[model samples]
Target: MSVKRHAFVTEENSISCSQTEQTTVQKTETGSKFTCQQCGRSFAAKGNLKVHMRVHTGERPYSCAQCGTSFTRKGSLNAHMRTHPGESPYICKLCEKSFSRKESLKAHMRRHAGVKPFTCVQCGNNFTRKESLKYHMRIHTREKRFKCRQCGTSFSDKNHLKDHVMTHAGETPFMCDHCGKTCSNKANLEIHRRIHTGEKPFTCPQCGKSFTAKGNLQTHIRIHTGEKPYTCARCEKSFTYQRDLKRHDSDPFNCALCNKNFLLPTHLRIHLRRHAYARPYFCSLCGKSFRWLGSLKWHQKVCICAKTLLPEF
Candidate 1:
């Protein structure tokens, strides 16, 4: 029995060694035979080599079941499946909002905690995800790898590439049943439906202001924190809202004081507020009043004569 066991062990070792040598030899031969003609690159398997050929030939065999989106690989098809499924399995523990993938769920959680883990190596600008970091890095690299086939618009991300493709196909998969309005994407359709449903789930933590869109909620939060992201190119004056900066920069309403144009009518009205002699900003020193705060401040600074003025404006 001991002799038989020794013989079996020796045979198993010999077979394993032979198999390893065969694998190595086969890999070298396979690499040499089925290498890419365009890029001069080798793939491990013949199927992978065929798929790599699609890069040169611009072939997309695998198509989407829902919208007939042609893709190079099965993995892309699987990812695209989530769009139709609307089955967000990955749920954020912080907000309890479900996302299709783990990465998306992680990004969604970042908004709740205000975390930007990924930072740009060149500019030190922060992003919530590595994909966004990659997109930002492209700005430093000046690399636009993805290009649109229809209009030649370039993007840093793959999703943007796919979205551009939809423009050529004229495919709007997401449709509203209530109003019969079509949207290019499901996310857009959802936001459009909010107009009819009157649903504003995103609430500001600082203020009780609600927003139908998450992007709007994000912008509104900046108001409470006084974080102005948009800036004027001419004067370099920053504003909490893009519209505010645009109005300030473009001057649509034609300010009567500065003789400048403004974008919004309300901004021009506010500028008019400074000129109106309504005593909006009152002086506490001599119980005096002025139309503008600057005038009241100036009076308070050099108030020697008016010791006792009218109590009310």
Candidate 2:
């Protein structure tokens, strides 16, 4: 029995040794000896496996000196460093636009070539960039990963969440040069600047009417199509704009100062002017200012100057 046990142990050791030798030979041939223990992924170089391990380990050794932004790979760190000094090495030949990274230049070239390589499987929509497609997918998935802590408002996009958070803090970083008006984002500031510049870049094809914003142009196009997307749940009334639907559903506007309620926004605006002591309507004869047109007319009727001027006319 002891002799049989010894022979079995020897055979098992020999088999293990043969398998190890075969694996080493295969690694020598293929040049992929370095394998990740965590993920079981094979790499040709030892340095590559070490770098790949950082993903699982959550290690970011390469960090930017200027911004202190850490990256897993040295190549990514080098690419990010260019953004600090505004050093754009990659240049577009057609538009003469410079990009910090080669990948950005390639994406810009796709616009010139009219090439959309990345496509959505669900919607069949094509995008120039993979990141844009990923963001678009969140719409179909109804995934609201980014949520505002203050308002409990959820946004699918991270940048949208960032912009929404600024509203809670009352942080307006973007300032309009023309009006000195502050906006939450640069896009809003640009649109506000268009009021001064009269730059209507978005034009309707059917009506030939131009709008300052692309969203306004899209809404204008709906007028030709007769498409009312915003529908009231209670009244079943459809509206071209979402704001109209909101107004239809909303209660009478209440004044915060006087506790007065108004049905129309115009009436609310006039009422607010009274509270603010803003007498915009002026009497032509007396040179007196009144908050409302009715008040101005009543003042002109009793004015001595108006009575004398009326007899002269």
Candidate 3:
């Protein structure tokens, strides 16, 4: 009897080799053919082939004892059990990061410097994980499937809803070992520790400005890149930063020359420099002048532009 083999396409598009040998059954004087109803694929044994049929049908009959993750076959269940033991045979060549699954190691290697190969077809946004792509789909659908148990706040993603629920519960699970300070998220706690440790991990490539958080560093990059995402509602003036937008929106005083309004007195004073002329104090030497007497005195002492004759203080 010839031994039959099976194959399965994994998440990475690689074919998984068959683990078990196929058993053929005899019917009457000849051989009996058994077919899997789900995938329309034929098999030898009803039991051994039943597991193989689950692979094509995307069915997970066997479940994990720890995490309750279901698998198509017992071999897959055995392979998943290694995840609970934290034993990863796959290692990335770029970053030297170990992953429980070979597919995970491939994804982790992309984050070494910066690489986003998988892009969304709908929005053209790139993401490292396929799960991220799934979550991003909800943004287009405007689907709020996950709801917070506390305040009934609905979010499209479960993680976002979980974050929202934390605010209502006031649950600060991440506590600093150095200090008693607590934070709702572990990443936020890690960023907040920089205040005590004086650590700035995120630095701008354009300017030498440093920030504790990557988001702040991204915003700082826009200052040099001149990428304005914020805009004013009243005047429709765009600004690179939110603080600039707020200042532009809240300005009370308007410039007489350009007719532009500014939030601070210093900003208005700087704008006045472009239009201002007629230096009142005149030089006794060349008739050169300045707007302020202090400027005239400095010019007169230097003997460069003009000398303003001062009477008495």
Enumerate clash totals for all models, in the order shown. 6, 0, 1
Could you give the candidate ranking by lDDT, starting with the highest?
A: 2, 1, 3
- Distance from true position, residue 13, model 3, in Å? 52
Could you give the C-alpha RMSD of every candidate to the true structure, in order shown? 18.3, 17.4, 18.8
Score every model by TM-score.
Answer: 0.46, 0.42, 0.42
After the best TM-score superposition of candidate 1, give how far the Cα of residue 48 lies from its true spot, in angstroms.
15
The residue pairs in collision within model 3 are 279-290
Question: Can you write out model 3's per-residue Cα lDDT over 29-114, one digit (the tens) per residue?
Answer: 12444544433334455466656544444466889989886765788688777766456778778666666787887678767757
lDDT of 2: 0.72
lDDT of 2 by residue, 1-313 (tens): 2322322231111222343342111122344265554445556765676676665555779999998867768997898788764678888999988889799999999989999999977647677999978876774455799876556789988878767756655566668877789986667889999999999999998989999999799779878977665655554556678677667667366677865557888888988987788999998887889887898888987888887777653
| Pairs with backbone N, CA or C atoms under 3 Å apart (clashes), candidate 1 | 251-261, 251-262, 252-261, 252-262, 252-263, 253-262
RMSD of 1: 18.3
lDDT of each: 0.66, 0.72, 0.65
TM-score of 1: 0.46
* Model 2 segments more than 4 A misplaced: 1-86, 202-211, 214-313
Candidate that scores best on TM-score: 1
Question: Across residues 209-241, which tens digit of lDDT does each residue of candidate 1 receive?
Answer: 888999899778776767665555566556677
Model 3 score (lDDT) = 0.65
